[model samples]
Target: MTVSRFYSPQSIAEATAILRQQSGCQVLAGGTDLLVQMRNGVKQPEYIVDIKEIPGIRDVTLTNQGLTLGAAAPAQSVTERPDIAAAYPGLVEAIDMIGSTQIQGRCSVGGNLCNASPAADTVPALIAVGAVCHVVGGEGVRQVRVEDFNTGPGENCLKRDELLISLFIPRPGVGSADAYLRFTPRTEMDIAVVGAGVSLSLDPMGTVSAARVAIGAAAPTALLVEEAAAAIIGTTLEESALAALAAAAGAAASPISDKRGSAGYRTKVVGVMARRAAQIACDRAQQRQRRAH
Candidate 1:
């Protein structure tokens, strides 16, 4: 297996052009996954377009609506952003668990999504937060919800000529907090056997207003457990309600038996993770309200 050609484009437009002109061209961001895949003969692209040099793709800034993160932004950048940590703590936790410090320095969120691994840590958290991906191609630009971005394991909805531009993550409301939790055999540097992210907003009266729960490594793509989330709406956090939500989340999961874990084990952990994540998120939301006061 040999990488025959390499192209480093300075601009998004140039990158898109090269993608349109060449066949079997794979876009390279941090090369954390692509390089290893190529080395393992899992991927052997004729043209490797290095997009790291492209400008305007690494900016991470706060916007009025929320945070606009450049696709090329490193995972460490997101994990370290005060605003991201304050608004979406789950996202911070997910990114922080992606890999070691060295891996975080070179891995980008865009790359994580593009790699389209079912065990990708950031996907579940981003999906739970209602994050949207901005994609640009020869045709134009469009936005896709993170939940719909990945089609299956190691597959995404990106067109052959499309380039992921950025991610638009809306800031949580005044009384909102999000948390991500995962279960793995090891504490770190291990893929999640089961993962869950919960984002919830509480009303002034302490009732649940909005809720989103997403689970990963339990299905082809990270799935939003709407029924599970709905179980908590219009109610205060209670053990019974949390248990019901957890049951729903477990039912919603479509895990398969694999080397990492068994389907039964994954399903059980999905429930446990869902309940724990919801409780953690609610606690964080309450804390945020207290801080604001």
Candidate 2:
């Protein structure tokens, strides 16, 4: 029997060294996913490196670049920032929907992301807002786009000795807004069967100038559907445009059958969620425009 080694590294350098030197070391951010995996025999790390005490990783900072969410910060803390909630309501909605209130207290967005569940709520929202992740390791720092971060379910792009330090999401500009929606078996405390996130920028004339559409629980990984965005751009998202958007989004999904939902059901629901989420985003964008005036 191997005894699990626990480590509470107070700095990135210390954590990186341990990860590089140890044969099996896993990061312990919120331990939301780590503990579950350990119990299920999915992961058996010899070393558990607690990084919550790492100076910069637990602090959320707003900047000209946008809102920087420290990887170690709790999901609940993200909603407490009024400025961030106002700027990126869709992200806040997604972050807030992660598990229940108690789970939110301990789960970090970074953990949800790195856990790489196809049903993770935040992935689509992050992709819709063009979020970027800052990763640190023995080789130093690098950035990865949120859309490109996860390779598949229970898998991520993180290499050995590497961990996400922070996530950066752009601040919504004037006439810009976003929204997220998910279909679940239950009203609350349920995994998303089909999730959609939409972000858009509208011109003064009410036509979309820029747009992003992303879907989760509909593929091996959450995906940014550029064609769906193209379907609604340059229009007020009329029925014709929305129909196209739905069709394109539906076409992008390649889900597998599961107890939560079947592949066909997930595909159809993604189209409906995509259209609804886009409409909500469009409405929010118009509201932002009015607020700006």
TM per candidate comes to 0.98, 0.97
Predicted candidate 2 versus true structure: per-residue lDDT over 88-203, tens digit per residue: 99999999998889988889999899999999999999999999999998888999999999999989999898989999988888999999999987989889999999999999
Compared with the true structure, all predictions reach lDDT values of: 0.91, 0.92
What is candidate 1's lDDT per residue for 1-293, written digit by digit as tens? 67689999999899999999999999988888999998999998999998888887888888668988788888888888887788888988998987889999989999998999998889999998999999999999999999999999999999999999899989788799999999999998999999999999999888999999999999999999999999999889787899899999999999999888999999999999989999999999999888888
Among residues 3 or more apart in sequence or in different chains, the pairs in candidate 2 whose N, CA or C atoms overlap within 3 Å are none
Looking at candidate 2, what is the lDDT of residue 202? 96
Regions more than 4 Å wrong, model 2: 1-3
Name the weakest run of 10 consecutive residues (lDDT summed) in model 1.
79-88
